[model samples]
Target: MVQRRYSGRMDERFEIFLACAPGLETTLVGEAKAAGFGPLRPDAGGVAFDGGWPDVWRANLVLRGAARVLARIGGFPAVHLAQLDKRARKFPWGEVLRPDQGVRVEAISRKSRIYHGGAARERVERAISETLGAPVSDDGVRLLVRIEENLVSFSVDTSGEPLHRRGHKEEVGKAPMRETLAAMFLRECGYTGEEPVIDPMCGSGTFVLEAAEIAMGLLPGRTRRFDFERLASFDAAAWEAMKRGAARRETGLLFRGYDRDAGAVRMAGANAQRAGVDGTAVFACQPVSALERPEGEPGLVIVNPPWGARIGKPGPLHALHRSLGDVLKERFRGWRVGLVTPEAGLARATGLPFLPPGPPVAHGSLKIRLYRTNPL
Candidate 1:
């Protein structure tokens, strides 16, 4: 197969935003910087960069920390509905949006005279529908119109689905970790896919799978299709060539995942198979007490143990946390640890020498933090 370099530039440049969990913007910055995306500006919930369509495609293809990618197309200041409608009609809609493909327009107003978001959305939707002859559908290219202080801006969701949905993991356990979050967590622990990784309570094997994929040089978006493909600016042949240009490499290390439930182990194995990283990852049905260090290398042991809010009685949970700490302290010498929990008390029960916790990240309704330790 011929590996061609893709240089598919859009007609216009864009301000690309890579969205992530609020606390993870810096960690995302690290990953993006390592991937050669530079001059990064980190915002509250994401990072922004200047690039063309090729950068958007590459960001969707490789940036594991981004929840979704948004392209700032264009916008204007409109004080009222009539002005908004008139301005929206004059803006060029045919540049990036396809008339044949459908579109979905959504609007939000904050401290703007156009207090009614529904009315604003209808106005823009009507303009696109009438101007480009594009049909309005519930499931279509998402056009987000932000009306802030009477200035309305348009952004297109280039990633149709969240990047966390890597198109694998057909089966997930209760409180399963998302691939994007798991990737960020792994990076925060300084894994870099260069060393072995162990997830003791590896529900559905998110960390191990992500580790294996990274080590094997697999692209996250390889198995999935992005929403950017639907836009008029998309180039299918170029995208196909870009996907083909990636080559997988061999790795000597093995990513290990253990779960107490036999069903979870089976599910994880199947998920790894689907992700094409099964060859480099190993999964087993085992308790934390049964976890022993693997030979040949001292790597990182990261776990998202079940928290008190998630399940079971507190006493047993505390003991479980204590036992996890004891096992790591007594056995896994020289291996760093990254533990995620909802409470500091549970982390303290582990008795490991932990550094300060990172900012609390929202995982569902409960907030969680990652507590790290130097090699013990």
Candidate 2:
């Protein structure tokens, strides 16, 4: 069901959904509350709040855990395909959509008379193009419509692309962990961007760079364009002011990533430079056997090592985990560890004392879990 708010003006306010991976709703809510955004309501796949256009802009600018922001525009009852076309054509399209900007409608149907999803999409697309004069093109804005049990609801994706892109990090390893998931794992490990961070198996430096950005106070959407800018409610001056008001600070803390692959180390370094955190986020070509504690306060050691679901056979991966576990237990005295993988036996092979595993999180096709430990 589309969540609703009763107090605000019905015409001005709408339900805003911050979509994320299913199991990470709690972590996303944590980030939202820390960023001062909401009286959040966490559901299965995301968190929701009641807001208008400015709130949407702020969410797109500040949030790090959300994949995309969806604004619930409006809806009506459509028992059949022709009724969907009729109500969609009369849906006040001009109030939010412009005549020049192109739009492409996508829809899903479940337990409804309008069982054909493609046919439903065609009806909505024709309505927007014919009624509002917005051209229907593949490269245009995406308009999502959900029809269930004869009720139709519409939403538009405010973020043009997934938030994990972060407008940087051009190169990535084969089984790269997403930046959004990385942020959540960091938060779950009680990381507040205050201490040093080390990733012994950093692929393209996603974890280290995210920590650096959090510590430096850089906004996630600072360097990217959003689909909301093309909407009719966009206020250019207000958006620019919001961006200008955010300030980035210098951090004396060091975030390090050590990879055995020299090419991966070079790629991570280049990505850090592009992200403008090269001064604080440094990369070195090394292995877990050579891992050492940094010359400062103990921080979190988060890693996304090779596992059976994504790559590598279980036998060698188990040895790698054992080696990593041995190193952390010996050299690192006060640091906590967060390991991301799908194999439970592999996490146990680490031999470090990990708390009870959390619920499984969806990463591509594999269901991965985050295994953590107290300061060792």
lDDT of 1 by residue, 91-140 (tens): 77887788988899888999999999999999999999999999999998
Tell me the deviation in Å of residue 23 in model 1: 0.5
Query: In model 1, how large is the Cα lDDT of residue 92?
Result: 76
Q: Which stretches of candidate 2 lie over 4 Å from their true place?
A: 1-11
C-alpha TM-score for every candidate: 0.96, 0.96
lDDT (tens digit, per residue) of candidate 2 on 1-376 = 3322223332488889999998999999999999887889999899999888888999999988999999988788888888889888888877777889988788899999999999999999999999999999887878999999999988998897888888789989869989899989999989888999999999899999999999999888998999988888788998999999999998899999999999889889999998899989999999899999888789999999998766788899999999999999999999999999888999999999999987799998889999999999
What is the lDDT for 63 in model 1? 89
Q: Which ten residues in a row have the lowest lDDT in candidate 2?
A: 1-10
TM-score of 2: 0.96
lDDT of 2: 0.90
Model 1 ranges with Cα > 4 A deviation: 1-11
- The lDDT of each candidate is 0.89, 0.90
